[model samples]
Target: MQDREGIGKIMTETGKIVTETGKILTKTCKIMTETGKIMSKTCNIMTETCKIVTETGKIVTETGKVMTKTCKALTEKCKIIKETGKKMTETCKIAKE
Candidate 1:
């Protein structure tokens, strides 16, 4: 009878340990699910940030092209003015002679 009581006590303790382990597993699963959700949101935010950076790069490239075009136009205009000035100086010398 004492042996049976000892066995019963051991079984009861084992049952309690199993129940507590199951509770811990349940909490761990919940924490993992929340972590997954947070990671997913972080990935979405990073994707959006990459898109914005890509768009900004394109805009900067286009602006560089426009500036290059403007510089070329200004250079051509200055060349033409220089040529005109040379022709006027020659004409004035010829008239005086």
Candidate 2:
């Protein structure tokens, strides 16, 4: 199993975003917000770190787009994502948005 628990982790489930000060320590741990995604290398936000409230590969934000690998359909977790009228790929939108 993936090691979700680390030196500063308390979560008991997978894909649970960690909001600790320094629990997150990689680029894969994305920072989600209303405006867009911040690929924070370290846990820098005041209270957010790798914190995806819903599920993995899904984001909670306003005016955001989280798409699938085909860039055609939005993931179920991203179905509510406001249509910014931007055609998005999962990786690009997550990084560029």
Local accuracy by lDDT, each model: 1.00, 0.45
**Clash count per candidate:** 0, 0
**TM-score to native of every candidate shown:** 0.75, 0.11
As a TM-score, model 2 comes out at: 0.11
| Predicted candidate 1 versus true structure: per-residue lDDT over 12-86, tens digit per residue | 999999999999999999999999999999999999999999999999999999999999999999999999999
Which whole-number lDDT from 0 to 100 does residue 12 have in model 2? 39
Best-performing candidate as measured by lDDT: 1
lDDT of 2 at 3: 59
The runs of at least 3 residues in candidate 1 whose Cα sits more than 4 Å from the true structure, single-residue gaps closed, are: 86-97
For model 2, the superposed segments whose C-alpha errors exceed 4 Å read 1-47, 52-56, 59-97
- The Cα RMSD in angstroms, rounded to one decimal, for candidate 1 relative to the true structure is 2.3
